[model samples]
Target: MAVQEMKLREKSAPARVRVVVEEAAPPMMPVIYRRLSAESLRQALRKMLLIRRFEESAEDAYMRGLVHGTMHLSIGQEASAVGICAALDPTDYMTSTHRGHGHCIAKGAQVSRMFAEFFGKEDGYCRGRGGSMHIADVSTGNLGANGIVGGGIPIAVGVALSMKRQKRSSVVVSFFGDGANNEGAFHEALNMASIWKLPVIFVCENNGYGMSTSSDRSTAVKDVAQRASAYAMAGRIVDGNDFAEVAQAAFDAVERARQGGGPSLIESKTYRIRGHSRSDRNRYRTKEEIEAWLARDPIGAFERQLLRLGFITTADIDAIRADVEREIEEAIAFAKASPAPSIEELTRYVYSD
Candidate 1:
């Protein structure tokens, strides 16, 4: 009887439960990492590097009196240009601001032809007519860079309207600065686009200033993206220096627009390390702020991210740098050797052919 009772007690004992906690699957990579091929990412890094080197070279040239007239340099906003353009099709159109070298290059303009334009040579996209601030490569679908603040916004809206009427799948990306956000054209264009459900993307490269004036002093809204609500469109704010973030936002907006989802606004919160223009003394901001932003160099940050993701090796980066350097040197040589437009032919393109 006692043996039976002991057996029953043993049988009643609770069974040990084994807890198997499978290590949580590594956090899902971002949309860009999953969507873009390795080659595409490498190309992105290459373009970022190229923009940096090109801007630096342009600055040096301006200082040496090789380039005439005042120019705005997109020295620190490389990622915003590259990331946004990466999401665009070759057939799509783009409008640029005065600070638009990066945009031109990102949209597939050749550095040689661009250099020729800067040199005012006949080989330029504008046949030596439009220089730095007005470089336009129609073959690459770049309408033109606007010297007037907020000028491109209305143009983009019009282009979008045209596309809608034609039933074409192409979209237009209008890139402007923080200052342009306050302009009347900005409001008018967005309202019209939203009402028509036009395929357009309004990208505000908000680099903390509209010329020498800080945006906080000039603008009412805390974030430029907040303005999109008035137009009943999507608005997103991203770290413009982070390529992945900018690209992801652009990709979403582009896809949405392509699907007839109407227009979207992306306010890239970036900082321009350089002054407003070649002549800006940069008295409005402190040296410490500039230094801090310099530390977040978009090219360097993107390079590091690429390395971490194993998309690029040190050797590859070195090779890309060498190649871009050689390319720039060749471009400079080509520009110097190209012929300038003669005075007799200066007014050739002023009228319709």
Candidate 2:
């Protein structure tokens, strides 16, 4: 009987396999023509390209020993900066992280002046006093980029409080990294903003690493968005490499804040192709990991999407690249030619002056 049972079990027909077909994820860009106009798409592409070029130029200058201080380049995170800024009104306020040149550019700052600032010229923003990490443009509504980790979060909340007190419809967007999420200021600011119903959007650009430490090692929560639940605010995770995804999420968050819906946390999953800063040798990450992300280059992927949608031709993309290159060269020339800050003006803008 045992032999017979074993034979039956061996001869039994293979169990029926069930294959579940999961629904495909949504496209990076909206399919409806009316939802995203060709002009707007083109502008997004241009803005992203400009940022990439500007960062490349800055990196080159730094390598040549032209720049005195260190700079944090947002080489692989252009989509996050451009997409979020594109969703904002010109009058809307934004606070930036140390890696904020892209934020300044997306917020309508001129590359010439930015270059001048990096070169420490008198014509630069902040009159050349604030270098790469501290560039600010009040006219463009950028409060300033903070050098301290998690420093800008509180400042953004304060700005939102001020806006609320004034009854202004504008919202504030705060850009910070995954590392900042672990800071005491992050929790305090978010709690206060939530309790007060401040009009603020806390955007976490989770680029996988905080300096040499991986976020997995530092953050208690797997997804930064999960923290929003503690504060009873809306939280969303987005593909930071996709411009359309980031833009859509940003639009909704901005609208919510403007309508007094209080703060929303957006965690954009992006990667920094470059090291944390110019001084980093990139010994922390594997070469294979870097190659994998480089293949998902946001700008290249977006260009392909634009071509496929017939919004732009190869020629159009080439022309845009050429124009941006020319602009970058001109900015470099302008920065080099600009005079340094005068000794007489050294103490001029200081508070004690």
- The CA lDDT of each predicted structure is 0.86, 0.86
lDDT of candidate 2 over 155-182, digit per residue (tens)? 9999999999999998999999999999
- Please write out the lDDT profile of model 1 over residues 1-353, one tens digit for every residue: 11110110012222121111122233445678788998999999888878877777777778888888988888779999999999999999999999989999999999988888988899988888889999888898899999999999999999999998999999999999999999999999999999999999999999999998889999999999999999999999999988899999999999999999999999998988778987888889998788667666777767667776688898888788778888888988998899999999867877888
**lDDT assessment of candidate 2:** 0.86
